[model samples]
Target chain A: MDKIKCECGHVNPEGTVLCEACGKPIEGNQHIDGNDKKTLLNMRYEGSARRSKTYTNSIVDKIWSFFSSVKVGVWLIVIALIASALGTIYPQAEYIPPEAVSRDPAVFYEATYGITGKIYYQLGLHELYGSWWYMILLALIGVSLVICSLDRYIPLRRALKIQKPKRHETFIKRQRFFSETEHVTTDEIHSVKEKLQQQRYKITEENGHILAEKGRFSRWGPYVNHIGLIIILIAALLRQTPLLFLDEYVWVREGEQTVIPGTDGEYYIENKKFIFETYSEEDGEIYKEALEKQEAMVPKNYQTNAVIYKKKGETVAGADPELEVVKEAEIRMNEPAKIGNGFTLYQAGYQLNEFHTMSFKVHRTDDQNEKALGTFTVDMNNPKHEYELDNGLTVKIDQYYPEYELDDGEPRSISKFPRNPAFVFLIYPPNETKPEVSFVGIGKNIDPTNENEYKLGIVDFDMRHVSGLTVRKDYTLPIFILGALIFMIGVIQGMYWQHRRIWIHPKGNGVLLAAHTNKNWHALKQNIEKAIANTSIKIVEDQQELDKDVSKRGGES
Target chain B: MSLEQRKANKAHKMKKRFIFRSIILILMLAAIVYALVANFNKDKSIYRAGDQAPDFKLEQINANNELESIQLSELKGKGVMLNFWATYCKPCEAEMPFMEKLYPEYKEKGIEIVAVNLDVNTLVVDRFIDKYDLTFPILPDHKEQVMDLYKVGKLPSTFFIDENGVIVDKVDGALTLENLEKQFQKILPKK
Candidate 1:
């Protein structure tokens, strides 16, 4: 029994191809066994342990090897995919349910979906994306990717970086493509070098031997892609942190100002105007209409002329604070406007304001006779002001209800449209502390018991639109975008590029050339043939010759 | 080293690697199981029953028709009925009279009703208040801050907060006089 001492002073077994401590090839220690030859050709870091142990004495070592396993990585990915697909079976919690349902999710689910809903609730699939298990799955995958890449990358990089121009006979012989020529001249070697250089191969020559390599960066492609994926996963997790991502919907009526939610009143947006249009055919009929009425008019475009403002003064108690206009922009569907450094405003939807204008008649009525005192027009757009009548009476427009209705004996506005317009008016006689209240509809009125004092009637009314804008602010957007770009680059590099290497050694006035590639053996063979096209170098593609040569060498040794 | 010794060393290394890998796999699986169990018992909502309500400030119309700001934190020791409603919502209109009817009786018991109006139109809110003769604090959530905070997907949502600022119950629809009384009883401070 004998132990071989490496140049680095580390003693390894005699049969070892490399120094176990430093991952360096142990020269002149040739066992030239079948397994040794396979290790030379395929194993990048020959000195390092190739397979994980079945049992470990220490707990930490056991854990380390678990994460380092490619099998674990694949299993994690498969499980995560299955869980994600299962999540899609029922809509995520964030998406709005299709119908008007109960606020109690359990009750709503049970009522709507029955047994499936029960299962969905019991399994906690309603908020699957944000669920702890899903988070753990992502975390495990991230750990797996990190461990798997680290385990292989360091050794591969070391092996690739310290590659030699001349290789062992066993190593050269084991190559998929090999060639030996007799009576080779220096001129032929020069021509081959020139052809390889022309083909963009980086060449290194030492001691009458040449090593040409290309697409070395492709070797790092998988690791780079893994890094990008890890970054994307981290960014996704970061998005869950408060203030990193904020998605809020704000409904702004035209000419109305409101503070943006989640901005802490730091920003305010006012809707100057909302414009809505529909597509019409040459026949002057709205496209996608049902019968004579417009059932579902194909929306042409919608835009909201919004003015963004920054809070100027400290909001004093009981006082309206001043806001300075930062930017004025028209936000349309698909076109988002950036507000400050964080927020982006997008036009999401619109609601039509049906009550445009209300024409009212002030009537003075007695028990015997009723006469119209005066006619007045109240603009629905600005329905906050009071109008003074000529009969020493003040008519203050309190509320304008479009599509007014009485539900369960309670007065309410059904919709934004002016299908049934109503108005609540407060009539002050002269200097009364409390004004008389009256509810007036288009053709009816909730008349006061004392109709002799004053009566109001709504003559006519008209309609207009308001836009719904979605304000979004995500700090992790840049990180997510960068990760996506890097991932694409990594994928392209890994899948499209092939790492190829060739070794050329002068064997007693003749040359022996050997070539190997991580992928695309046919392409590497073609490249080699093209490199030595002008020379008299004939390639030995037959495996039998290589085997015979290796056996003879072994016999001689 | 002898061939037998070298083989033994290799076997030992393989054993170590296997144990290491197995440990990591087991730990990850354990973590997944823990997360699943924890998730099953967790309440996802920010404002759920038995949880302390997040405080907010809103502009409320006072007795003089002037806009005055009111903060929920100021009424910490008093029972608070935090209601999220829009003027357009029918159930909200239906429930206002009942709320107004109970306000006087509850006010004597140190109970405060903070009705948050989600409508952008101030005039509509003012008129609705005047029409209903509601004496309770009518807070106008012009930006719908309180609405968004409570995650009010539907209108007329009411949260009954006890004197300790803890949410006792959350009712989603319009409440009648009887329902309001029952909810108020739960939130009313123990005397």
Candidate 2:
């Protein structure tokens, strides 16, 4: 190949096998007989270089290069996979409150995932998806999609559009399939060219020789593949929608109607029937093993329904969706109801709760003082409630589980629901010099150690059973859908397109032809060769005879 | 074709190929990023079994020596037992002696217990500890950090954890001695 001035004006960087500076092919090209070869990026880069204008190599440029280079693109994928996995290994390092996450946090951090995991959490790697570095990595991939596609698209299109060459001699000779055949007559060569053309192959003939080719899309598939990828990437970028999750549990008792708490306005959640289903005994055994493994829960179903109310007077909520309680709905494991603002109401967990008031009294032990610590109601869900006794003591009804279970080994629930609700009570005494708090189980009250002023007595106790339900709404579902769609499309386009090429050279005896294909070459070459072989009108005895006839015909023409 | 012309033609064609092949890689990356950003602002719902418990910043009479309060943020990505207790509470007092016994042996293995004291009587609180032979760190919660945040209306509410510190469950009232020991084993591997 002779040195050609690449549009880059850099002499195509001399034997540049490929244009590193401008990204255009610089040698071994058989398509360009004229000057129309430079791509958009090449022309621009060349123009800037020629003007000697100060071009600040911007971040976009680095990103452009990074994305275009297969090496860089591969690196980004590696980084993302590793980072995403790391994120799974650690926590986000953020939370709701101190008491909410009460635990020995320091030792916990040091033990798992190790020092590195902790560092990753601090660096926000635990929450790597939205971090600046992660986005940049993704953006680099996006740019790569553009640059890589641009690099290949223009050239592939130009190559596809290339007209038949003046002669296919050198090109055919360079192919792995070229063969010298001499037994053909001049008439036979003409017939071969005619046959190729009849078979829908594009051909160019010179003197007594012929060149034929077919199925050029295969050659351009990768370039097309690149464009598809870019479109996919752009689609992905468009898909970047940061989500806001509302993960609070709200009470929706079997009979009451309530609104789901989230930024996307209130939703009418009516309890048509809060029902629970259990696994069959046999299936439970099979799934019990699965449950022990913590595999997905063997779910039966947790169903509910309620009147959807736009307002207190808005046609009565769940009883009619449009104007009142409408329909009965059932929710189960792996099944959730889509509510509002990309929210899904899932049946995460349940509790056997209760609602009851406990009666107690406090009398002064000291003859000098008289005070009465009275009774109160401790709502299980709302534990902060308390009663102030006349004697200046505050009693908060802390935790109360109607069906309580001990944390020992067996996981057994209290046999009866509301018949016996367990209570955790915390008592506070008012003292200017020093305040004191005491914890007591509902039936196990201990009097003040002062052993002088006051003693609390339990007069009466009551319990009722209720169901505890957990609510959840996460917003990443749509992105998952979109990603699935893109992957399928890309794979189909990449896997199905086949590339086929043929080169035919005219020589003295007849036409010398060769065929090659990038993919599906096995079947394609066989068919094209068969077609060409059949097209030869007649065969001369030998090379000597074929040459004699071809030269004589040349003279006559 | 002249060598120069041939080179130009090849350059033109190669550019197209480069562009095409790389697009797939780019799209894959974009898809991953999009998925991530989509989930970013949503609640992580991170507190789970095998997840680290979240750390908190706390003020204790002793942390003053370090001139800094406790930091709860660091505790996540590990397992721990964060119990909120008050001085006068019987259950809280009953649980301390047990926690004190298990803490030393399990602390190195990964188990941690933060006894947040919401004692009405700080003076009486000291005597209660001395009365039961307690050894674990008792963090005073005068600010009610644990109370207001955890919505703790009950005393001796202990949060259990697995290897990763995410709170697995919250226990109210005094755990039976056998139960506390079993839980300590569950949260921490044998040292």
* Residues A1-557, model 2: lDDT tens digits: 33446554434322233343323444553122211232111121111111001111444334444555556667877887887787676564342122322223333354455788557556766546667677777666666555565644544454344333433344344343445666656655665667667777777554443446665544444555455555555555544443433455555555545555442223556665566665655764666655676645455765555344333343211122242443345655566666545656666655433444456665555634434555555443233346776656776554444444554752222322333445444566675433333334445554445543445565665443233345555454455456556555544544564444454555665555555444464665565665557554222112223222233221000
Residue A112, candidate 1: how far off, in angstroms? 3.2
Candidate 2 lDDT by residue in tens digits, B1-191: 67788778877854653454446446666566555655453334324344445445565443213233444555544446778876535456566777777777777676666677764324334544666656555667643434544545555577786655556676655666677877777666433
- Candidate 1 lDDT for residue A21: 44
Instruction: Give me the candidate number with maximum DockQ.
Output: 1
- Assess every candidate by TM-score: 0.68, 0.48
lDDT by residue (tens digit), candidate 1, A1-557 = 34566565666554455555433556654343234454333334343332232223466555666877878989998999998998887666555342333445565556667899879877888778877777887788877777777666755565566556766565666566777888788998899899999999999987888899999888778788877887786676666654577788887777778777666667888888898977666545544254336666767789999899988876632235578989999888899889885889989988886566777877765523546576678765446568887777788876677677877986667754455767878888767757787888876688565653677776666565667888888899889888888888888887789888888878898988888776787888888888888788876473534443345222100
Displacement of the residue B124 alpha carbon in candidate 2, Å: 25
Calculate each model's fnat, 2 decimals: 0.21, 0.06
Model 2, DockQ value?
A: 0.05
Residue A357 accuracy (lDDT) in model 2: 48
Q: Residue A139 in model 2: shift from native, Å?
A: 2.5
